[model samples]
Target: MKIDSLTSVQGQQKLFDNGNARVTKVDGQGEQPQPQQIASTIYHKDDPVLPANYGTYDIKAVINENVEDPETMNARYNRVQELFGFGIAERSVDLELGYLSGVESLSQGLRDKDWGFSIQDGELQVIEGSDSLSDEERSQITDALKGAGVEYAAQSVANAVIEMIETERSPNGLSRSIGRFDVNQSNFADVVDLRSFMEDYQVGGKYGKGIVNPNDIQARYFGAGTGIMDQVAAKADETFLYKGR
Candidate 1:
């Protein structure tokens, strides 16, 4: 029962000396003994959290980014022509069109968007206007033209559109330039419509008497790949034959 009295206290202290064991002090004033605090195991407890090794985004960000910049959007527009092209044709678009500047806003309506008109490096806080194509406008224009499935004539149309918007600033000029592109971006192979040619031979009006839109001739006996350039002069009759619909 009396353990302390039975034990050699000094020899016991030598046996249990693993350093700093927790203990409590008891006072005669009927107060409960309070436990002593222990030192933290980790040395750097106040350090900041470590950063992640890879980029991360939420569902909202994913949706927003996809909508703002599609990976690739298939472009298809109905081809309207009075000549042989009175149907549809396959078209291709640029992949980088989505990432072009100002495409998110300007593609909706180029005429409606306002330009931050500055006279000389933010000097003139004048009236708002959409008279010119800055970098933003240029990007928007290129995106639109390229995304419209323009090929071969893309450079010329883009140049003409950019110049018109930059210099002439006329809405009519802009519209006409766009319409002019419709002519240039044609699927019609610079040839007369077979139906129109037949009609002209019978009882025609406009498409007759060499008043053709393209003026190049197309017939059952004739062939495809006939344009301003045959594109493949040697193989025009072989590779690019028009299977008449």
Candidate 2:
């Protein structure tokens, strides 16, 4: 049967007039019929479609407007401290004490799996761990510190080793004498035995006298004082006793 000769031809034309029909055109080169482009549908007020709305907002601007400036923030903080009868104990860090700084670095170095140093009995030493530093590694670190304008670089490196050994926290959260020093991204040419270096010197364990290290004494007092203040503030006229550790 021919398509045009069908009885549904009139019904199909009526469907097309009502926008319910798809039209196609046959290609001239014996290709399949292709769909004709259709005009977009215009939605009316009665159409069942949800409306979409979009907008942009500046959150940073809102935050900045409400935030207080640095000076004002500091003033408010100080005022609060005064109201609580709290006085902050400040300690000046003397970078010139390169030995102390080195010990601090030692703490950091051991934490970072780097070279470790220590200071005991008025002497400073570096630990020779299982993975000892090579000559090339030592030279690289020395060069880096020198290039970085680190004064007393040698002393600092040695102290870092001491800090790791003396205050190196154990797995169980206690201090230990023997600990490994590991450095990453550094190569040393030769490894020295720390034990041999301290063979002539004796290791001091117990501090019979009062706190020797000024820094350590300051820290103990500062910590104890802070706790006292806290307790005094909370108890309000109640006495609290704290013995130095």
Candidate 3:
């Protein structure tokens, strides 16, 4: 009826609809792709070498890392031991001094070895004799008895009294006095041994003219004795007489 439609629209619309409705096919063939299984890899290695024992370990390195130097550590240890030793030694000396001081405080009248209170004339005479002894005589008697080991106890008492007196006047005097006494005692022993050796060996030969041929060794011994006596006198004066004063 109308002019034949210039355009053929009948199949064109169908083709467009078919194309829009079509679904793409997926190929589920050959080994279906597995999710790439990746396991977490953890690598563990051996521990480093270490020292076996505790103290035996390289002390230097340990000290460097943990404490101080080797020398400082050793010195500190030794100093501790020394301090402990000194404390023990000082305590012993103090105890000894205390005992001696107690003995020294006793009266001379009560110091007699015999406990008898008899008033005999012979005992009185003996006491009077001792009272009259000069310093030199007292020293000689003390020395003789000391050599026999019979007067050490008495001398110790006397020394203790002297120490107390010195300590009362000067706080540290007793310690100093003890140190000096030890040194002098050693010196005295050495001198005596030296003299004895010289005498026995006859180090020096005879000298002088025919009639006046004198043994140089004997002369030397006399001189040495005189010198030693002088030194002894000086030391005694310094130690006993002037210490407290």
Best by lDDT: 2
Q: Could you give the candidate ranking by TM-score, starting with the highest?
A: 2, 3, 1
Q: TM-score: which is higher, 1 or 2?
A: 2
lDDT of 2 by residue, 151-192 (tens): 333333334333322222222222111222221112111232
At residue 166, what lDDT does model 2 achieve? Answer: 23
* lDDT per model vs. reference: 0.22, 0.26, 0.24
Model 3 error, position 209 (Å): 60
- Alpha-carbon runs more than 4 Å astray in model 2: 1-111, 117-127, 149-245
Per-model TM against the reference = 0.16, 0.18, 0.17
Write candidate 3's Cα lDDT for 1-245 as tens digits: 11011111122111011011111222334233222111111011121111122011111111221233334434433332222212222222222233234324334543332211101211111112223544554444334333433233323322332232232221232222212222132233321222121222122322111312122222222212122222233434334322321
Residue runs of model 1 more than 4 Å from their true location after superposition: 1-130, 152-245
Candidate 3: global Cα-lDDT? 0.24
Name the Cα RMSD for model 3: 49.5
Q: Estimate candidate 1's RMSD in Å.
A: 39.5
